[model samples]
Target: MNGRLRELSREESLRRLASVGVGRIVFTHQALPAIRPVHHLVEDDGEVVIRSHDRTALLSALDTVVAYEADSVSGDDRIGWSVIVTGVARRADGADRYRHLADPWADGEPGYVIRIRPELVAGFGLPEDNGHAP
Candidate 1:
């Protein structure tokens, strides 16, 4: 209970984000906040990519502001790090180089490739304290 929380640098945040494959996308739907679980890929340039079906609401979120989040946690010790990204969501044309980087968890033809170019990237963690940085 005495552990301190530290902020993660943008580089570290993106690195952690890239290491995870599943995250949540938050956007406004019907004037309320909506969250959807999605499988995503983080490009080296810090772009988050995901593929969605044509009928999915997220596909309609192109050119809008959205938030994406990913995290990792330890079950036994309750230590974890979480990264949140806020950015504009846009649909990437099929010819976009990173379009093929989207890896969907489902087994169907991919629909739209959406890329979130982060404007704000923030992360924090409760590192296990053993009288030193974890």
Candidate 2:
């Protein structure tokens, strides 16, 4: 699909990601793996926007590369899926711009947004390895 890029079905991959809203946001701080659980919203342009406070550990390096991992699973039901989006991160500034696009919790105090433009997006369905389980 989508010109045969040797990837998972576009719809399937996107579905796996869209189905979940909570996941771990992995970023590098001092060259070490730093992951924080986050709630994100996916944009139409295929970008993920995560909201957080200025003091959040992940905000230390806005210029660094980041990878966000979101997954959904029901072990009792024997169903699960995970999606990883790897990209560069940058702080989203500007009131109007952020207000229209950003969704931050915690009263917007020192509010900051992390925009991740995935250069590589991988999705996996667990327990069955269906779609694109990676």
Candidate 3:
């Protein structure tokens, strides 16, 4: 693949994150890194929301720092983009409306709506041999 990696600004990164349909939540479990795929939705205020079950390991990470990552790649060209958000996770109280935003991958309805307020946003794009930068 012939392409360049273009660094995206915080604002741009958030935009990219917002565009993606799903992402991964990264947290520490058993003193080791653990990652779980999650359906995510970027809020208008730039916060990331994800659904979770009570028994999931992510619930243990509430109020703690975690990293969320999402990316998209072009099937033909392999050009892609990615965004990583490091933030504090907290339960969104009364998540009646927010609950449907991030779908749960497990069985049964989601037990909680987890919100991550981005503290650090980083992103990059691979623009498939394009002459112009992303």
Number of the top-ranking candidate, with lDDT as the measure: 3
Model 3 lDDT tens row, 1-134: 23468877898888778776788999887788888887888888999988876446877778889999987756665547778999999988755776556455655464678899999998887645222223
Give the alpha-carbon lDDT of every model.
0.76, 0.65, 0.78
Which segments of model 2 are wrong by more than 4 Å? 1-7, 54-56, 75-79, 94-110, 127-134
Per-model TM against the reference: 0.81, 0.71, 0.83
Which pairs of residues clash in candidate 2, taking residues 3 or more apart in a chain or in different chains? none
| Candidate 1: residue 64 lDDT (0-100) | 89
What is the RMSD, in Å, between candidate 1 and the native fold over all Cα?
4.1
Cα deviation in Å at residue 33, candidate 3? 0.5
Model 1 misses residue 45 by how many Å?
A: 1.0
TM-score of 3: 0.83
Per-residue lDDT of candidate 2, residues 1-134 (tens digit) = 23323344545655666655666778776677787776677777777777766455876658777788876555555435667888888877643455543333455444677788877788655435453323
Summarize candidate 1's per-residue lDDT along 1-134 as a digit string, tens digits: 24488888898888888887788888987777888777788877999887766346785477889999987755565547888999999988662454454445545555667889989999887765221212
Candidate 1 has a TM-score of 0.81
Model 2 residue 54 lDDT? Answer: 40
Winner by TM-score between candidate 2 and candidate 1: 1
Strongest candidate by TM-score: 3
